[model samples]
Target: MGRVGKQTIVFKNPPVISCAYSSVGPKEAAGPLSTYFDHSYEDELLGQDTWEKAESKLIENTIQGLLTRSGKNPTDIEFIFAGDLENQIVASTFGVSSFNIPYFGLYGACSTMGESLCLASMAIGGGMAQTVIAGTSSHYCAAEKQFRYPLEYAGQRTLTQQWTVTGSGYVLVTHGGKGPQVEAITPGKIVDLGISDTFNMGAAMAPAAIDTIVTHLEDTGRRPCDFDAIITGDLGNCGVDIAITLAHKLGYDLKGILNDCGKMIFDNEKQDTHSGGSGCGCSASVFTGYLYKQLLEGKLKRILLVPTGALMSPTSGFQGNTIPGIAHAVSIVMK
Candidate 1:
């Protein structure tokens, strides 16, 4: 592939794989041992105790796992770029404070993971930083209250609804010399499918997925089967179906090949993950905890991870406008 731009940064000793991730979850978590639930506190109120504490605890647990797995001291990290969906980013702030790592905060709803990776790669590619950590987290309770009503409020969710995951996901992207060099970053090309429906995020995000996938294939000159897996962040069940339909329309077959984090993270009967899982933490946790390990184990070679976000604000919802969606793709290859 041709260089996208001037190579301002070069790694003297590209970062190699030391350790990838760590997960903390509720005991007897649904799908994977890596998955966790916050049972520390159970409350029906929005902005209650569990929501507040879970966010910070999720971050703390995630950082601790990363440190323990990598066997690196917190002081070794140069910076931390973390984000969450809570108001004023309270969870991320508290989580980072516990580790005491200097960092930047961000928010992109469900697209946070891709956003963080893009920025981290740039910092490493530009020689601006040697070691940086980027991660995003979301709590089901926190997000629900902020974006919708409290669960106790018993708001009916439609088939197109996406259930939020109560967890956190983090990735340690260091300078190329220290870990796996970022091989390629197909910056997410925003493609609006001209959809509008706050009630059905799955519908909104499907077009964005189609747009990104089509553009990415064109840009890289690769086909759908070229990758071992095509993963979408929070498309859930309905969105996955829509994406598949869209792919077929574009002359691509993604039926059995596509996977959604929301669907994979929990068993339908046991967890009732409902349409599927959303939240910043859903994709983040799955990528770092499940997908990264799969790559290390040789089960997957090249993978396309696309994190989708419904860009409907409260104002937009109030105005009765449909939710606009966006998706960003990060291609990961194991050699």
Candidate 2:
């Protein structure tokens, strides 16, 4: 071949998608058929526990599930990336230890799933590794104790409150010729509505989801009908309504296609989920465990998942600042 001509080679086989997840606490603590409502620690004593214990257990269980399902050995995994909302990343640290896979820890509030997926996809695309594992977890009791107080305290919650759930979710991403390849990722664009209500995270995150979905549609030139379903993270009841209204103003009719994980997981009247969605585990578990399974079963062909997060700190609230929200989108394809 002359210098005028050049040749390129590409991998013939691509990575396959595999996921594993776990949740703690009593499956029926909230009530009959309320297994999904209660987070990991609803059955535990508040102040007497540490986030590391539960977080590690959940992560370990999730990874084990994935390994078993995919029939892959832990040693074959090239890297592991994990995170949680615990102080000093206690859960992630202990959780990754059991696998003994080389990895990095990450944090991006409730939007951890989207953030982690973005990074993992980029890593695989760049050929930095052949296989990678990414996941995030959150515990209701741990988060509540750190962010507010123990549930046993029974403190009055403000109208802007969101109930955190305890659970862990994990996904395995590998290079070409191996695992489920990442199809597409709509990088989360930061959209600030200038909202200042920390107590009401549902409202704070609603606008961000709206902004992201609109931008994603615009950028990809996709219409609402292009995808089979559009799902959101823990927006709860109030946020879901806000999302519907804003989406209507955008000229997209999502009345039937739109759903929120927070609202779908529990029966509001029976479980008393209160205001509806919360926690990293909320969307992660539902998406990976439930939705993913459905897709694999031919129930869904194309799906869009937009996970939202309210980025607020205790100091920000005390300083009279409102919570800011962010959202990221990941488009999945089965065909």
Cα deviation of 266 in candidate 1 (Å)? 1.7
Name the TM-score of candidate 2.
0.86
lDDT of 2 at 193: 77
Residue-level error in angstroms, candidate 2, position 5: 31
Task: Quote the positional error of residue 230 for candidate 1 in Å.
Answer: 1.0
Model 1: how large is the Cα RMSD against the reference?
3.9
All predictions: root-mean-square deviation over Cα?
Answer: 3.9, 5.6
Query: Which parts of model 1 have CA positions greater than 4 angstroms off?
Result: 1-18, 32-48, 176-181
Tens-digit per-residue lDDT, 112-181, candidate 1: 7867776776676566776677878888767787888987998987766777776666767765433334
Summed over model 1, clashes come to 17
Give the candidate number with the greatest lDDT.
1
